[model samples]
Target: MLAAHGFVEAVEQLASGLGVSVLVLSLLLIPVATELPEKVNSLLWARRGKDTLAVGNLSGALVFQGSLLPALGLWLTPWRPSRDVVYAVILTLIATTWLRLANRSGGVRPVWLLVNAACYAAYFYLLTLR
Candidate 1:
């Protein structure tokens, strides 16, 4: 907990130095940092043709983060949904639905997975427009 606090403080300082809002800095950096390990593991597993394990690893992390963290935040904070939050939720639904449909219709192609990256890029673009 203490280390996390220190890391957050360092990120805030870096954000200030870069003239970036802490929220923006965190939105850009935090998820990538937190999800990196899962992503790397998934990639390695996929490279080894352990497709199910790779997908399971990534899906498990997503499920935990997507559900539990948001539930905890909602329970612990007087959180109000902002425009960005709404946009994010909408994009998440869209991406998830797209993936599900694609998987149902056929196997998910590499090109189809690019849509997820596009969704992330779209979120960043939306942030820049704000």
Candidate 2:
């Protein structure tokens, strides 16, 4: 925990020095750094034919990170989210609900995948906004 905190502080300081947005850096780099190992593990599991395990781990990580990271930010930081972040969160919730509804029939359809891709594009658009 201490090392993670130190790393975050270091990254924030570096962002400050570079005149970059700390939120942007956090959104871009921190999760990628932390999740790479799990992603590698998922790939290895897939190679071993444990498709369920690989997918479960990937989805579980997404849910855990999506919920916990935002909750932690609300708890640990001033919690003054910019308008974009709030919109993104709302969009996420809506998309998640829509996905749940779509999954009720047991399997995903092609249109659902396209909608999810569009949602991802929208989220990335939110992030890339200046």
Candidate 3:
């Protein structure tokens, strides 16, 4: 708990130094910290030729986070959709659609993942506009 609190305090200080709100900083950084381990595991599995495990590990985390987090947020919070939330949802849908189309066309090539990265870049750009 102390470590977590210190981590957040550091993030807050960094956000202050960077002249951005802690919310924005957290949005930018926290997901990377949270998701990096799963992504690394998936990459390792893929390199080992465990394609199913690689995909499952990545998709399972996405599925759980996508469904449960929103459900909990809706249940626990007032659930007002801000501009940021709307933009994020729209971007997420766009990325999902892009991935789906890529899957339908053929296997997901490494290059195809660039679209998702572009979506994330778009979100970061959008954040800057606020």
Error (Å) of candidate 1 at residue 44 is: 6.4
In candidate 3, stretches whose alpha carbon ends up further than 4 angstroms from where it belongs are: 42-56
Residues 1-130 of candidate 1 have per-residue lDDT tens digits of: 9989998998999999998767768777888988999999999999999999999999999999889997998999999978777777888888999999999976899989999889988987887786
Record all residue pairs in model 3 with backbone atoms less than 3 Å apart, i.e. clashing. none
Q: Which lDDT tens digits does candidate 2 get at residues 1-130?
A: 9998999999899889977778657766888998998899999999999999999999999889888877897899887778666756777677778888889989778788777677767876776676
In model 3, the number of clashes is 0
> Please, what is the TM-score per model?
0.72, 0.62, 0.72
Clashing pairs in model 1? Answer: none
Number of clashes in every candidate structure?
0, 0, 0
Model 1, clash count? 0
**Candidate 3 local accuracy as lDDT?**
0.88
Clashing pairs in 2: none
- Candidate 2's TM-score reads 0.62
Please report, in order, the local distance difference test score of every candidate based on alpha carbons.
Answer: 0.88, 0.82, 0.88
Worst 10 residues of 2 by lDDT: 83-92
